[model samples]
Structure formats: C-alpha cells, structure tokens
Target: MDPKEFGEFVTAWCPGCGNFAILKTLKAALAGLDIPPHKLLMVSGIGQAAKTPHYLRCNGFNGLHGRSLPPAQGAKLANGELTVVAVSGDGCSYGEGGNHFLAAMRRNVDITLLAHDNQIYGLTKGQASPTTMQGQVTKAQPLGAPSNPFNPVAVAIAMKVGFVARGFAGDTELLLDLMQQAISHKGFSLVDILQPCVSFNKVNTYAWYKERVYRLGEDHDPRDWSAAMAKAMEFGDRIPTGVLYREEKPDFAARFPYLAHGPLGKQPVDRDALREVMETFA
Candidate 1:
C-alpha cells in the first residue's frame, strides 16, 4: 500500500503545527503495515488533535470530549478484526479523559492511543494543559500554572501497561516507527507524542525539543521494567524517545476465551434467554 493512499485535504490547523507531522507519519505507518482503509478504525475526542480522523481515509468516529477511549474499546469488542487507534490531545486525553485513560490501561484493551502532548490547550487558545510544565504562564493562567504536569508515560509504565512508548512530532521517521509498533502490539499501547503547538505553546518549540530529544539506543531493553521506569522519568535536560516498555499480556477480549469464537456482533443472539432476563427487571 502506498502512503499516498491516505491523501491529504484542507485542514483547520495552523502552519508548522506538530499535528501535521503526526498525521503524515501515521498515514505512512498504516500504509507500511499494509493496513487498508477498510481494516482500520480511528476514534478521537474533541480537540485540535481529534481532527486527525477528518484527514484520514478510513473508518473514523469523532466523539465527545475526553470520551474517545470508551468508544474505541467498544468498537474493538464489537469487531475484534479491526485495527483500533484512538487519537486525542494532552487536554482531551490526560486532562478531561484522565479517568478513562487509567481505566483503559487497567483493561488492557487491544487498541493504540496516540496522545498529542503539546503542553497547552491550542484549540481553546493557549491555556495550560495537563502536560504543561509547572509554573508556565499561559493565557488562562496568567499567574503561572500552579499544578504539576501529568507524566503519562511514567504513569503507564507504573501501571504495567502492555506497551508504552514516546515519540516527538519533530522526528517523523522515529514517530512513524513508534506508531507502527504501538498499533501492532496485541494489548493497550500508548505513544505519548511530544507535539509542539506552534500557535499556542511557545515554550516547547521545534528547536527546544530537537535539543533534548534523543532515541533510545540498542542497549536499552524494552522488556526491562526497572530500566524503562528510569527512562520514563527522564524528562528534563535529556529526554528519551522510543519504545520505553513492552510486555505482552492478555487483552480485554482475551480474558473472555469464548470471544475467540467470533466478535459479539457476529454471534447469534439468544432472544429467548435475553427476553427472560429482561422480564426479571419488570
């Protein structure tokens, strides 16, 4: 499959926005893996990054704010054959959808989460987001951001999520590799991409990230839990990017061995049994 198979169109995004690189990398990743538009499903919550689906030529769902995960998991449950990928921004995924993010990790759903961590609320015009650096001043917080920024990769690793990786939008090649690996993982995978909101976030610019971000070398073993934890906490001065951790475990559907027979949608429903159960509530 050619990467151009996912053609581009007019987007409601600012020039030099990191989202453009992410979108391009994602398309390349999907095509590189030979995943056709029909076999893929993109789910996203309301935010600037949520607009990713609009530019993709695949099955997609634009859902409520902070509510992409639930529907992504639902789609996977309904059709286990589909490749589910959920996309959202720092605010949508780590702020408003914080609880669901934790739940999804616990469930270990067979899906990939592309978190566009630009550190500010771009769509709402420059408010500090969940991943915003502490004490950073923004339009919404003129007094400086009081709360500490959320560390998604650290939290995911601590929770023992099956797959956890970090990518920088500035590095298209590495980001594409990370996206492909995350999507291919059998359990919940998270690629917390460090995206620069050029229009809203001035601190973490392209040059800023370029200086600090470096790929994990061949010496770093992704399966080493302790090593991965140390790598996850390395955020200042020198930041690491790449597959931080990987552990294959039973996914949500795998817990139910009977599901292997077929997806719930394909299975014949026992109307009589369902009716009897429904009548009990009467």
Candidate 2:
C-alpha cells in the first residue's frame, strides 16, 4: 500500500505546523505496515491536535474535550480486529484528561495514544499547557506559569505502561518507526511526540528540538525499568527520543472471559438471554 492511498483532506492547521509532518509520517507508517484505511480507527478529542482524525481516510471519532482514550478503548474492546489510535494535545491529554490518561495506562488497553506535545495550547491561542516549562510566559500567564512542567514519559514509565516512547515531529523516519512499533505492540502504547505550534509557541521550534533531541543508543535497554526511568527524566539540553520502556503483558481484552471466545462485536447476541433478564426486571 502507498502512503497516498490513505488520502488527505484540506487541513485548518498553520502552514508550518508540526502536525503536518506528524500526519505525513503517520500515513507512511500505516502504509509501511500495509494497514488498510478500513482496518484503522482514529479517535481524538477537542484541540488542534484532535483535528488529525478529520484529515485521515479512515474510521474516526471526534469525542468531547479530553475524552479520546475512553472511546478508543471501547472501540478496541468491541472489535479487537481494529487498529485503534487515540490522538490528543498536551492540554487535552495531561490537563483536562489527566484522570483518563492514568486509567488508560492502568487498564493496558490494546490501543496506541499519540500525544502531540506542543507545550502550549494552540487551539485556544498561546496558553501554557501541562508540559509547558515552569516560568514560561504565555498569553494566559503574563506573570509566567506558576507550576512545574508535567513529564508524561516519566509518568508513563513509572506506571509501567506496556510501551512508552517519544518522537519528534522534525524527524519523520524516526517518528514513523516509533508509530509502527507502538501500533504493533500487544498492549497499550504511548508515543509522546514533541511538536512545534508554529502560530502559538515560539520557544520550542523545529530548530530547538533538532538541537536537543537525540536517539537512544543501542546500549540502552528498553526493558529495564530503572534505565527507562533515567532516560525519561533526561530533558533540557539533551532530550532522549526512542522507545524508553516496554514490557510484555496481557492486554485488557485478553483478560476478559467473554473475549476468550471472540470479540464482542463479532459475537452473536443471545436474544433469549436478553429477554429473560429484561422480563425479570419487568
């Protein structure tokens, strides 16, 4: 399959937005895996990053603000055959949807989360997001942000999320590989992608990330929790990108007794059983 087979629609993003590279890389990754558009399900919440699903020629669901993961999990549970991806911005994933994000890792659902970490809330203009550095001045905080930055990679690794990785939008080849690996992983996966909000954020531009971001060396072990935690904490001058941690474990659907037979969507409904339960309530 060709990347162009996924097709594309006119996007509302800024011309130089990092999302454009991410979108292109995602298409290439899916094409590389030979996943047809029909087999993939893209879920997103309200934000500039949430607009990703709208541009893809695949099954998509645009849910409420910060509610992308729940529906993505649900879709995966119902039809295990679908390749589910939940896309969100830093604000949507780490601020408004913080609780859901925690729950998703705990559940270990068979889905991949693509977090567009632009560090600023672009959809609402230049506002400091959860990942925004402490004391960073934004339109929302002229006096500078009061709180410390949230480290999502660290949090995910600490939670022992099945797969934890980071990607940079400026590097398409690396991003594509990370995307494919995250998707193919047996359990829940996170690819926290560093992106530049061209119209909103000025500090962390393509050039800035290019200088700081570096791939993990072959000596680094992704399965070692301690090593992964250390790598996750490395930020500022030299940021480490690539698979930080991974562990083999049973996914949420795998543990369910009913799913042992088949996925819920593929199973035939037992009308008699349903009628008996309803009659008892009646």
lDDT of 1 by residue, 216-248 (tens): 999999999999999999998999999999998
TM-score of each: 0.98, 0.98
**Candidate 2 segments whose C-alpha is farther than 4 A from its true place:** 279-282
Residue runs of model 1 more than 4 Å from their true location after superposition: none
Tens-place lDDT per residue, model 2, 1-282, is 999988879999999999999999999999999999999999999999999999999999999988999999999999999999999999999999999999999999999999999999999999999999999888889998899899999999999999999999988889999999999999899999999999989888899999999999999999999999999999999999999999999999778889887879999999999999999988
Assess each prediction's global lDDT (C-alpha) against the native. Answer: 0.94, 0.95
Residue 61 of model 2 has an lDDT of 99
Measured on C-alpha atoms, candidate 1 has an lDDT of 0.94
